[model samples]
Target: MKKLVVLLSLTVILSACSAQASTNKDSNKDDKEKVSQSSEKKQTSSDVYVPNPQLTDDRSLLEIGQAFKDDKGVSSLKAIKKVNETYRIGDVELIIHDVKVIEHTPSYSMIDYFHGFTHEETFDFVKANIEIKNTSDQPVYFSPIAILESSTGEHRDWEADIYLEELNGELAANGSKKGNVGFILDHSDKEVEWVKIFTSDLLNEEQKVTNKAQEITIEF
Candidate 1:
């Protein structure tokens, strides 16, 4: 009888050990699956692109540009020009921080926006980092680049701006805005040597022009 009891106890201990081991194995698998799902979710979120991101920080803009380039397989052969030039038209101040030309082949998701500007699968565009400030004590209407003319004789109006940060229109008193403005070039492969920016006339609350428009040029 004692021998039978010993054998039964050994069997029960083995079964318990086996059950614990199986539970541990199942738990590890669940943990791994959860981790994989989380990773996939993060990757999917990052893959979504925003063309007209409302961002003011320069670093964020650079990251967004990098993400766009990566997503669209874009490239740039020319070096970026750093033009830290500032122009003051009456109470409004405009600053151009940098400019670069990029060749982009929009992905299928981005075709809608690019189709409005170009029919080609691949094209080149110019992007400029800029800042505008209303330095007066009252509100005013202004546009940093009402017209953008390239040295290659290509002209683009404010309506063609792809960045669309709302940098144009009314600015509050002593308020400032900083962001990027981009335009698709007509000649996709042409080299741009310089660009001339025509700013809109400063207007008062009555919508009357209080200050004349200004023309500024930047060399690349």
Candidate 2:
């Protein structure tokens, strides 16, 4: 009877150890899966692009433009034209810095944003850097580029702009803003010799037109 009792005790001990080992293995597998899922989430989040990102330092419009190109992995960039012209309407001042023609191949992560513009993986576009300021003591509403027409007869309204820099809309008193505006070209090979910009009418706080809209042309 003593020998039988010892044998039973040993059987129970061995069974408990086996069960514990199995439980530990399952817990370790779950931990590994959780860690792998976390890694995948981090990688996916890093692939997303943020538009109109905040600048870390004071960078020129040209420098900002180059950074944008690099961020998007542009295959080719051609500065087909450069312009340094200023237009003033009523209490608002507008300046055009430069224009660039770029060829870009969108990554899989960027496909959704570029889908509306083109179906091709590789596409071309024209981008313009501009600045606007309100010199009055009161706020005013204005848009620097109401309508953009390329020399190849392709036209895009302000609503179609890809660069959502929030450069349009109400301008605070003595406030200034600068950014880029880009439009996809219908034909990548088409030559762009010039682009005509139509500015929106300057409106006061009462929504009354203080100044008529103007047309400005920039040649490459």
Candidate 3:
């Protein structure tokens, strides 16, 4: 009878030990899941892009230009990754997808045709495929007169734009637009190494024009 009682006690002890082991395994799994979820949240937060408030504040063209200079200017096309990266210039976010240099591009109008036929007034164009995004709370206007500042300090604006209807327009809060813009340059046999792209509110002449415009720069 005593042996039977001892046998029963051992069975009960084993059952209790088994239940505790199962509980520990389940608790360990829950801990691992919680840790994994926390890591994912951190990754998502790090991936989000936010513009610098100091750079995004309403500022003048010259002030924005100075800020650009201070930040060591913008990134060049070669430096940009294939993943659509947003760059903050003043209050504007700019992405230059591609830049193409076309030789002997025809001028914008019949006047160009008349001039070309009469005095050979043809020119070359540097076409750019760009995307601009406004991150500010207020609406911002973009100018088609994006200037190309050469390494030698020569600044030239677009002569003809056929990629988009109007280069100048208003972009609402959190708005984005993509289009092609072209710049006219003197026909040259030499290749351009790099040029900086500048968009300014100072280029606008309307009554609602604000001195709070910014000059955003992108290098290509």
Candidate 4:
């Protein structure tokens, strides 16, 4: 009888130890699952790249070479990228980009109050952030870039533009960087409806041909 009693106690102890071990394993699994979930949430929050949208088809920037035709100011066709889908029509080369239309807006700062307002204007300025990927092997300098508006098809005509005046940014060959590109949208010119942008240095001179040249619609 004593032997049977001892055997029963041994069996109970073995079963109890197994139950405790199983409980510990289950607890550890739950802790690991919670930690995994927390880590996943943090990783998701880190991956947001919100680029400005108004960079689509910047016609004005494309025309920087045309508006200011001097060799120095003219953005060389050699310097622009191939993704722009352009061909040489005469001596002019068209540079293009896909811009996100983020703000078709009016100047709402204290600066706008110097004149007077009539109504909520139809976007006088366009602003966008662009990712400039330098596909060339050499680096190039930039001017306070101008935003150009395209008149359809491939033509480098300077449209409504807002000159940045001081654009001395650098780009690494085969590397990528991001910067802002914009245009002065004129409420008066219907040609300024949609825009294209290009960057250039001011030391470059403009080729003088009048028609689609920049007109002072609004000075900001």
Candidate 2 displacement at residue 193 in angstroms: 0.7
Candidate 4: residue 88 Cα off by (Å): 13
Better of 2 and 3 by TM-score: 2
User: Model 2 clash pairs?
Assistant: none
Q: For candidate 4, give the lDDT.
A: 0.30
Give model 1's TM-score versus the native structure. 0.68
**1-220, model 3: which lDDT tens digit per residue?**
4553343333323323333434444335434434444432122112323332211111111221132222312211111112234455445566655554443323233334335223434433455555555556665545533446544344564333433323345544454444556554453444555666555442111223343233334443
Q: Name the TM-score of candidate 3.
A: 0.44
lDDT of each: 0.62, 0.62, 0.40, 0.30
lDDT of 2 at 19: 38
| lDDT tens readout by residue for model 4, 1-220 | 4553343333323323333434444335434434444433122211333332222223334322322222112221101221322222112222233332222232334224312322433333344433333334543222222324443322221222232211223332333333444443334333333343433321111212111212111111
* Cα-based lDDT at residue 16, candidate 4: 33
RMSD of each: 27.5, 26.8, 29.1, 29.8
Q: Indicate the worst ten consecutive residues by lDDT in candidate 4.
A: 210-219
Alpha carbon deviation, residue 49, candidate 4 (Å): 4.2
- 1-220 in candidate 2: lDDT tens per residue? 4553343333323323333434444335434434444432112212322345311111222332352343444445644555766789899888776677666676566778888767988877777777676778886767777678887888876667777665666666666556677788887778777888877777777656687777788887
- Candidate 4, residue 175: CA error in Å? 3.5
